[model samples]
Target: MTSLVDLLHHPLRWRITQLLIGRSLTTRELAELLPDVATTTLYRQVGVLVKAGVLMVSDEHQVRGAVERTYTLNAQAGDADNAEVDHDKLRTMFTVFVAGIGGHLDQYLTRATIDPLADGISFRQTALNLSDEEFTEFITAYGELLARYADKPDTADRTRRMLSTLIVPD
Candidate 1:
């Protein structure tokens, strides 16, 4: 069986997973959100995820003789244990991650609002020098901080945000 990261090697699946993490959306909605991908291609990728038990059809309704499915991440099944640090898998993941970042940035720059300071936009890469123990402790703390917000209730006062991190030994 392909690992979760391997399954996510498909850009469409990766993007779908990213979008569905905390919310549900219909197939039509996903098509609208990912206009660049052909509807057929998107559907194919989604089907793979559904088969793999990562994406669940939360709801379905008949519309004009057709059934529309609303999908949400099946948190339990979608969960992937911390990825093993295999070179090939890491390469594939990084390729997908960088492509996603490029696509998002291209779209974001054209938007009407892009206040770097006001919106807290940042793009910087820095090297870190730390003992193995220190690195382990730092990453562990970071993960805990993220877990603290995993179930934060949505509120009008808070806007959705994406945090992308790619840490590799130098």
Candidate 2:
């Protein structure tokens, strides 16, 4: 857990992790997605995460004149229940990270050739009630669904196809 915290301490590293959460992206692709960051700096941070076991090289291929390595997060690197850490701080960081990405995407789409509204892009919030057992079941089922499509070539495209689910206790 300490290692996870250490790895996530850097804002850029946390942004990288957030971007790669459920997708595999090559360094070049990540650089393009995160335009504010320098390519070399992003690559170095990715390498550190890879060496630290928080990320693994999911694919490697020679493209043009160089090798492009895609990475995925490693699930075994952190404990889900670390008692000593402040959960609120972690949650706040993640919330900010997510908001930043959303803001960037919105700005990019507005300036680029794409029309997000016409494309049906949206973000939403909802409330739900469930027993602890029901919540656990929902999480397990969702994990299975994510795993089932984890390796599909079109998985990334599917991810962009409109969806965000957040479950909060009420």
Candidate 3:
């Protein structure tokens, strides 16, 4: 359990797992999708995931004396769904998740083209004061809403979007 939780501790690994959830991708494809990460580092992270059993090679073929492999995430392993997830570990996971989102947005913004509204790029913060019971209800509702459509199969008409959420009480 600890190993599973720790496997996603790295920002890159967590992002890789996120990208692989509900999808299969080759190492080269991942590198192209996440051009911000160096080619060598991306390959190393993919290897880590493969060794940890979080990701398995779904396809392999020999072409021009090179083996091309594609990977897919093990069932629910890419998600931080351990029964032993404590507050501290949860915080660590959330921190890593947020950092990865921030990094990706930062990298994307570096491109010469800038169009936040057209792309629907939005960020906002609000303070919610709720009693313990209300807070629990809020969390449950949020989780249910996210889960309802989180695993919708990727389709040509649908575009990939990143959504990260954080909840903290003062």
Collision pairs in model 1: none
lDDT to native, each model: 0.83, 0.74, 0.83
Across residues 1-170, which tens digit of lDDT does each residue of candidate 2 receive? 24566567677887788777667888888999889998789889998888888899888888898888889898886655355458876686467656656755755566558766877767777665777898799789988998786656654455454245565566
| Residue ranges of candidate 2 with Cα displaced over 4 Å | 1-3, 60-68, 80-83, 100-108, 111-117, 144-151, 155-163
Tell me the lDDT of model 1 at 24.
Answer: 88
Clashing pairs in 2: none
Q: Model 1 residue 13 lDDT? A: 87
Q: Tell how far residue 33 is off in model 2, in angstroms.
A: 3.1
Provide the global lDDT of candidate 1 against the true structure. Answer: 0.83
- Residue 8 Cα positional deviation in candidate 1, in Å, after optimal superposition: 2.9
Per-model tally of clashing residue pairs: 0, 0, 0
Model 2 TM: 0.66
Q: Considering summed lDDT, which 10 consecutive residues are worst modelled in model 2? A: 155-164
TM-score to true structure, per model = 0.74, 0.66, 0.70
lDDT of 3 by residue, 1-170 (tens): 34676888887888898788678999988988888899999999899888888999999988799999999989866454677778887888777777778876986698799898887788888899899999999999998998898889889988677787777766
Ranking by TM-score: 1, 3, 2
